[model samples]
Target chain A: MKKLQIIALIFSILFAIIIVQSCKSTSNITESKFGAQLWGENCIRCHNTPSPETFSDTEWDVAVMHMRVRANLTESEAVKIADFLKTAN
Target chain B: MAFGQLYKITKEISNQVNIHKMKNLIILILSFFLILLMNQNVKAQDIQSTDEIQKLKQEIELLSKQNNSYKPGKSQFLLRGYAHSGLQTNNNGFSFVGGSFNPLLIYKQSDRLLFETELEMELVGSAVELGIEYANISYLLSKNITIRAGKMLVPFGIFVPNLHPAWINKFPTAPLGAGHEGILPTNDIGVEIRGGSYLGNLKVNYSFFAVNGGQLNDGMEEPEEAGIIHHGIFPDNNNGKTIGSRIGIFPFSNSSMELGFSAMYGKTGARESDVEDIKALHYAFDISYVKTLSSMSSVLDLKAQYTGVNVSDANYPEHDDPDELYTFDNKSKTWFAQLSLRPALVENPIVRNLEFAIRYSDLLTPEGAEWHVNQSQTDVGINYWFDWRTVVKFSYRIRSGFEGGHSEEPSHGGVEEDGGNSFFIHWAIGF
Candidate 1:
């Protein structure tokens, strides 16, 4: 079991490195992209991410605020998400 | 000479009376003209007031338009839902289960007002049970505060509010002691004040709520052996209200780690006469850490939580005979740890969205209980995310201690026995 776990860990690390290199080489990450990326990365872990156009600016503010506490999101991350959602529509 | 004098007197009297009548007619005509002039003046005043009202209406309409323009987006209505179905096998046999159809509705009534509701329908055997998961209206009081009222998921722990949704839950089943019959209440009808604020490098988030308290249930035949205290979702049986609060802090600016603490306290008794006011207190501490390895293109998430509940000096009196009473240890504790790794950082498109997760949970009942009440479980799962809102999950769960029976009676049925193992596969989607 220990050997298997170690092997799994090593394999994961190698795959991660390759993925990161591929991502860095492919795209330019902007603030909006970063926000969207985080939204896709974190928000989707537990549920589907709602469309930014699904809510108005004020509504997004409230929704993000509620989710921040519920999901244990950082203030900056929540703000970025809020900004993305506001502009997404 | 006498006839001519009489005719002169008659003509003089007639002339005087005619002159008086003419004077009276002139005065009556003048009075009618004065009344008409007064009515014209009143009509002029009415017209002036009507013009003022019209101007006010126009101003109000203009103000409304301005308000609408100031709002950045139009009101939104969203409908989202998920369905879960699976098969499980244990010591009994393999059985097909119809899990649930959960529908959520969110309406943005205005810039400051929002209404959201979720309904859950789960198939238990052949019968379907419907439950309102949460139905609440929230109003933004300010930038940093909001007030919500109605039925809401209890905010006591991280799992209930954050990971309870089928699409988001990493594993097929909930953690031990985190379910509805766990140590703490899962949902409550209440009013809550919640928001987030920044203090220095740390972001603080908080929720404080008051809800209907718990209730006491004792079996009619075996009052002493079956008596148990648990959460109540319906109206309060007594005046006492449960107060719960959770506060979390993220010290890092990058949103990587968070620590939170939650507590609830209230009396749980139907009436003063049935039992001494059984005051229930619950506490939980939780932590979550997430890190993205830029080099590996992988994200790692670690989470853990510890929760406990204590009932103060509980005494159960026999329903038929109040004189006969019994007491039991009214304490319960539970904890869980979980780890998840997403290989999305991998360059391979096929494996990028796949995630592997493992979790362990333990639950304990108070000492000197009527039945054995210690349980531990381990689960390993894999999730494939088609999108943020859609997922396919498969998990293997190994459960020890306690078989199929009532949660209240730990000694009944398969007490102190292995619960066997099961495997489940579910597809969840939300839009």
Candidate 2:
């Protein structure tokens, strides 16, 4: 009986750990591996999390122009950022 | 003992996972609440820009008007008056304490019609003037047009008929004697048509009338010809009554441009002036523009005009001589360019609608034109809009050169010199 109980406890503990792990990543919908990696390196430093509604469509249009001048963000990187922000919300 | 230990281990692990989930849950809820607060702020700002508050204010005004109406079986009457007094000085040393009162009386007859009349009094010359500033039965032709006739203020150029000095401009005075010259005619006996279309941005106006051309009582003064007394109001002048017409267009809201031309000729002349029946032609062009500069946080408005008057030689009906000894030709022109700048466009509790402006004008007259003079007046002033329809103005003005020499008025009792210092205040209202 003692041995059986130990085995059951071990299985339950492992199950709980797996559930927490699944939930941790459940809401992080940055699905594209390349997009997520790029965001990790470029965006996460400035912002804790990316959200779309931070800037209006027109505001984003102006911001992109400013970023190009100041940050020298490449066209592809800008496109990636725009897509992420547009969908983040 | 081993089974009990295993149970304890399982329970501890479950508690740990639950606490972790609670922490994450709290973070998510807090973040959402923060976002919601931010969104509310953004929405409030959007509402302000859309002028929703103005709509509410208009509704309040309408309600107040209804509440103030007379009870059934009685006539409703309203009296509103405005007054102002100010001490002002200019860099050129012209200064004074001057003011004006423009009070209006209104009678309401249901929603279809209203009667209105205004009287004006000025401190300069301590002038007291009374007239039916606007007295016409306005027949609502349609939502787009109103036809009115009677002794009506002539609907001419944007400013000629609407020059209250107090309401439309910043300067306590007006464009180069525009206020005092009494050069421009005011009210006339005529029919006027006025209305709006194009989404309330464009206004169309027209008028036709016959009037006692030089009725000083009507706030209009006609120039006197040499040897001809009261040339403008004499019975002979009206026996050959003069006719005039005007058309005005406001292509956009807050901007109006008008071009007007009037010609009157008849056997009208002062007695014995036989003054051959005289024909006179007058043409005036006025253009005004207003712009809202969001980038500069200011508003700029410009107004300009050019006018010319030609009088033909008259034949003496009483004189048998082939040539009359007294014959003169007269022509006059005036031009003005003005700029107004109002910073801090938004109104606050302390600072209201305040504008600073400058104007340069040159008025030209025939070297020997009857009752005319050539002079240039430059003015700088500030307009403080106390309310929607009330404003206080302070201006400093300088005038120079009676172009041809001394002004014709100098030959009379009028003052003629390089210039003189003048200061004044005015109060105005419109419904």
Candidate 3:
């Protein structure tokens, strides 16, 4: 139907926009640096920033992974955040 | 001739030849001996090299072995949740009520999969009423996609899943129709696909789901409850598939703003019960902005959402008169806007921990339904943060509405303004 086609077209346009912007992003940079920035911006989205020392390194792995699903963080972003947490902790 | 001399000379010649031969033989013998000695020396050096390598390998083994006490376990378990107890005073009287604790269990089966659930237990009268608010298993299908199955908070808006916790909610109560009895359903049984990504600097998240959605309570338990949507986890004989989606966009680099859109569609009537096919459609728009202003030394947080539901015209039995049926344009809408400010960076610790919030909410339902409501409510509150996950909130609410709207139809006289006022004090903590 025409409605379905229009919906598909809108989604395609949105996907194209995302791809174009992703190409311009600094995604190629080191994850540690990106993770550091992500941590500074994201953890406060719902609650306060958790202290790095509050959890063990292994505990952070589970905690951050949970947040990945709960907060809807990207896989790379989760891993990078995990890496930074471990290093900081 | 001198024969004896000649013989002596010949003998001398022979002896000289023999001496030359002996000299060559002795040189050959000495060379052979020197080569043998060099071979022995090389063998000795080889043995020493082999001994040193053996020693090095032993040291390497010793250093390679360690306790390894801190490596990740095969599985992980964490207990997390929030608890709150509150008392409210109305125009009539005050009662110590609404005490509840939500215990969450998270089992990380692996890095790629997890199981979690929350038990919402509340104290009502003298009994503890408990319910499983959500229970689901999630598998990380890929870096950008996650597949989940079980009871989940319907992602119609950000509030239900992300900010309903008492510690995070600025006010003591839910915004006007956003609560359990609100137009929106809290959660449902379903399968969902959800994920998030960074579209350049702009962040995005989305959820798509299929659920066995709400059923119309036509066999009204109460005369007023007719036409109400009962969203329990039960199978509908209609067998219609209910599908929904929510997409959230955050445009700021600081992730301080999010705009969301949502929609859901399905049939609400049960076919086995011989009810006519009735369809329902729902839409919602929500926005949230939370920003820390450096110059002002304060944080400004704002949230707003508008939700609308429309169901096809359907007849429902009147509880008072069993044979009689009624129908109405089944439509409902609800909206709430809340803003809060916190001086988090103030020099004084006590003052910095304080927050002020105000919310305005409005709602409207079908004019014919007993549960119909036409009114708006305003709430103002002050909250003090004990820590990041603990808070004490004091809120006052004023609800004003058109008389005879939610309960019944007005008489010959046009509806008059009606409402109520209440105050609440609550303490919430998360662990």
Candidate 4:
């Protein structure tokens, strides 16, 4: 069906972008503390930034994981954000 | 006499020698005793010094323990909220509304326990109303599982829990059937277990809950006036319980694509009642995809959901009123799709963040229902983000096919049967 084709096309493009981005040297990207920066940048886009101490380290792990999928963050970016949140409290 | 004098002289000389020797021996013994006393004093001083050092060491250990006991990130409480104000214009006229001020309270008890509550106050014309949206307590059982209890937002779909925030909603209003007055149950008193895990390159999340079943109103005068099946707000007269679950999958590690499904089932009748117990079943499917174009500094978000509800044996008694003869349908369905594009991915000094979005929704009720049960709406909006948690939105909505003709004023905002169009400009902020 045409709908299937459109969906496939979208995924293909997304996968292509991921492949390209992954090929680049990420040494410079990981050097900066992406955790705190990404947390402020992405988490607040939808709702207020909850105080870091609002959830414990274990709770933050789950919360950040949920948001990562809900908000569309890369795995590395999600992990970094999760790390900062767990320690920030 | 000469011999006795010589003997006495010799004896006297011997006595003098003996006396001198005895005196020398006594002095030597005294000197030895003085040395022993000196040694005893030095040993006592040494013992005292050792005891003082031991006391100082114990004090240092106590201070160290106190310093370690002061945890930097312990339990805490916080208050945060959001407010919305806007103007809406329809066929009737323009009205100014001071929409709602919702305050949320969050308490973190420990690494394992948390509590959250939200109170919503809204102004309708000159009247004010207050309600509790959600109040729940959660305890983490492990790294991947949590147990939650209390009044919570129903986990039937993604819209209520994820996108209902005023600042986050793509449009000014919710899609048909998903709003406060929607047919779908938006909140429930219940307990749930939720968690997430990763499988290879994919991620998985799930929630399972049990709650009081919906209330059934069976004493209505007419079939069309059926009152049963109020979404689980109050204590259930029936002995039935509702069970629900939702599962989601993220297939790719690099891509933000989520696919989810949810289902709930329960009975809505009292035990051994005149009316046959109604069997209620509901299910929903939802998906979301987000893509960021680094070259263009743009982001695209797509989200959609489809929900359906079915009630079995909902036939009602016929009444003398002619208009009430129609039987309510056993099934209803609703769905919405939304797309949003944010052009300013990078923070621009002046332009900041700008986003455009469009959404379409449809709600279908059981055929032959007395009221207007079929509804559809389209919304197009533009959002200007002053900051991450604050936004100004301009939206135009075209709504049709609403039920009307009730004498009583509507509890929540409901349009007339002949639906009208409206333009709304609302400012939303979270703090």
Candidate 5:
């Protein structure tokens, strides 16, 4: 019985060590992940870091048009921006 | 070996935990600094926006002040016209008085330059005429000298060339053509030099004129024989030249208590009624006193005038008799007196215009003549000023003159029983 207890204890220790290592590696990866593609290039210019659901589609439409003039958007770009605004909110 | 390995692993785990806590502390501090920086940045942005709004408000105020400086100065335009239609009933028959339309247009280019013209229907059709009632661009030459050119009213007596019955006095029996004799042609279409200087508390105006004479009519274009000639006075434009002067004194601004006197002498044009153009000479003199008394109750105006004319008859070349006294060479004197009042009425809030007035005048023919025919005229009128440039007027007039003794022969004298009454209503709008 004593021998069995010792073996079980060794296995459990190994598992715990593996779990810690994986958790550390995953957290580091999350921190380094680039949000620039989702935010900086598109959303961050008009919106803060808040959720998109904060504004309604109509509100977003007005906000986007107001910014579009300054952004110098072409017709197609403006349409795309409107579509993005509607869906974002 | 197993024990040593276990210790080393545990020790590494402990160090990792410590490092995680330190990382969290660093993140908290950095986040606090970021929040402070963001709050400061937002405050600065708000201040900048406020400054921009104030600057915009100031710019708007400056633009409004610049708009009010481009408006025009003192200017005047005149539109004068009369339209009349009358129905008369009498024991003999019912007659419809012919309607007449007299239209006059006048424009003032400045304080001095004036151009005027008048057109009216006459027995022979339309009589169209134009004259420079007053033309010399006046320069405040001095405190005393006022030199003028371009036609002017011959400063003689109380009447000027343009003083027609349709304008100043609309009394039917008011010795119509008596005021303007061949004596002092009221208008001399010539140049004049004048001076209006103040002496102490008195104001004086003196003017001299050289003019073209021989322009006269009884406010009507019908044949001279068709209308009753007041005091046997007819305009004989047969005059060629005339010189005259006027002197006046004003005691106060509200009251023009003045005495104006003037005289003129000139050669006259031939009479259209006669075949031959004869040599004619004329002399005229006039004097008048005008006073205005203002009281809290009402305002009153009193005026009187006397005029005399001497003319050499054109048809009867050998005779120097004035038309009034055909027997003993030609000479006539016509005179009149008038009083007027304006009773203050309710003040209008919407239109703060001036009040209305009522006036009466008694005009007589040649004085001391066998005929003592005179006119009784009374008028009640209202005047409203919309602005400095526009005015509207309504008036009613009652006159008794044409019905009196208006026999062609002076010896017959006038019959008061034959006199008739006339009533008229007038509306005038002008700018």
Candidate 6:
């Protein structure tokens, strides 16, 4: 009984935060060749940054999507990172 | 008259033989001269055919491009993963260990759909072992949501999916309680809804899933492996599905820090059995902070997580006597905290590549269970970076518990029973 209550409470709080915060925030989408910045910020969080030349454009497509899921990146961020790798390469 | 006839026949025979020899010698000489003339003729023709050869090369290049164009463009395939080879000395003896090749395959069917698979191959003793860590397909539903199904890593904590890779982990070995017998679940079979968005200044992401929860080991087949839950196994033991989620909150604009919370609720005991209604609640909290201190010319990484499982009261068979049923407060708890420091901006190349890390972890299982124990471990480690995705790690560990690193003996135990006071040297590479 206590366990259920605790889980319910946690979920409720999480939902409340999502509702309140989402309303206060502006969309976080900007397209300014920001792939370089996205690549640096997310890659460094867990491991070192990989070079743009490390993968081909097609490989980067798959690689960035894998990272998108593993690191919880938005689809927009994933696409921008992919575009940067393609352009840089 | 006979003698005269014989002499005449002999002369005729000799003349014929001489004629035959002359014809043979003439043919041999003519054949040799013919070969020599052909060789020179071929050489002269080659020198005159350079333009033809160039035209042929151009044709070949065109054909190559045509072949490349015929390849399918809608689908893409990628092979990437990590591998490690190293040596170690546990309390039992000095030996070579830690050899594995983990490969991940991702095949994109369209812009929003992909199939991913990860295979783990390890060198164990004299044989090679193979396993499928996860095989799943995901579809991007929208900006804030994606759907995935099949076997995948449980979102119980950050370590399993994100930080357990050899090249990414600062230490050579895993934290004490993160292993096979640990409180955290590694993988599960389920459907998941995963995504996140920027909320104000905060970046929040979550993975919510429903899985056939892990099974409660009954100590039937292996006593040492009993009393605990076995994760990612096949064939559901019960109809109840476990519902779980992991939510990560990144408070900083630069995403330097992440705080995570995870919760799982489901029935684990076998259905149509004595303890079908008994359920388990698992929860975890994790935090990671990383920063580059310009003044100190160094980088610091700090990580910590706490995880526990609460199983409702149930009667389980005792390890010693199968007929004897025993019950206790069924719960398992584990926690680990680690810090890593590296002079990433130092002028000296050698100094800049060196990293130092220390960690403390504790594991506490149900007291009366076969795998029960109150244990603690401390590890000090150093690593030399070869590049962004390669490193050589050296670490030493100290163990203290009622039986030290041994989690067995009472029966149905987990982890290496003899791995106490260990030393490790590992080389990890990611590609």
lDDT of 4 by residue, B188-213 (tens): 89898765544434555667788886
Better of 3 and 6 by DockQ: 6
TM-score of chain B taken alone, candidate 6: 0.80
Rank list by lDDT: 6, 3, 1, 4, 2, 5
Q: Write the per-residue lDDT of candidate 2 for residues B1-431, one digit (tens) a residue.
A: 99999999999999999999999999999999999998999998988867877888899999988877732433345665455555544445534444556676555453335455666665545555443355555554443344556565554444445444355545545554243333444455555444322212233333445554432111012223332222223333334454555544445332223333333222334333344345454455666665557887765566666655455554221123323333445455666677777664665643536778788877765554344567787878777765554666666676776644322221001112234544444343332
Off by over 4 Å in 4: A1-82, A85-89, B1-73, B219-228, B319-328, B346-352, B402-418
lDDT, model 5, position B231: 19
Query: If scored against the real structure, what TM-score would every candidate get?
Result: 0.71, 0.55, 0.79, 0.71, 0.48, 0.82
Q: Please, what are the lDDT tens digits per residue for candidate 1 over residues B1-431?
A: 89999999988998898889888888889988889998999999999999999999999999999998786554666666677766666677676656778888777777568788888887655677788888998886655566789888888878887776777778767777776666657777889877655453345567778898676554344453443556645877678888877877666655467787777777776665445376677778999888777887888888899998777666655547867766777777889999998876788877987989999988887554553368888999998988766778888888787532335311101111125577767677755
Best by lDDT: 6
Q: Tens digit of lDDT per residue, candidate 3, span B1-431?
A: 69999999999999999999999999999999999999999999999999999999887776665434544577998888888877778867777656678898988999899999989887656678788889999999877778899998887886777778887888777766666656776789999878776665557877778888878766645566767676655765468878877778887766778898877778787776534477677778999888888998998888899998888887777768968998887898988999998999899999998999999988888888767788888999999998878899898888888533343211001111124677888888888
Enumerate the candidates' DockQ scores in order. 0.07, 0.01, 0.30, 0.07, 0.00, 0.33
lDDT of 5 by residue, A20-59 (tens): 3322222222223233322223232211223446446544
Extract clashing residue pairs from model 1: A16-B296, A17-B296, A46-B168, A48-B389, B297-B345
Q: Comparing 2 and 3 by lDDT, which wins? A: 3
- Top candidate on TM-score is 6
lDDT tens string, model 6, B1-431? 99999999999999999999999999989999999999999988997798789999999999999989976596899999888877777757776664678898999998889899988887666677788889999998776678899999888887777787777877766776776456678788999988767666568888888999888876666666556777777878999999988889888777789999998888887778776777888888999888888998998888999999888887777668878888888888888899999999999999999999999988888887767778888889999998889999898888788643324311011112364777778888999
B156-214 in candidate 5: lDDT tens per residue?
55544312323233222233333322223444456665544334334444565666654
Query: TM-score: which is higher, 4 or 5?
Result: 4
Docking quality class, candidate 5: incorrect
Model 4 error, position B279 (Å): 1.1
Q: How big is the positional error of residue B7 in model 3, measured in Å on the Cα after superposition?
A: 67
Interface RMSD of 5: 45.7
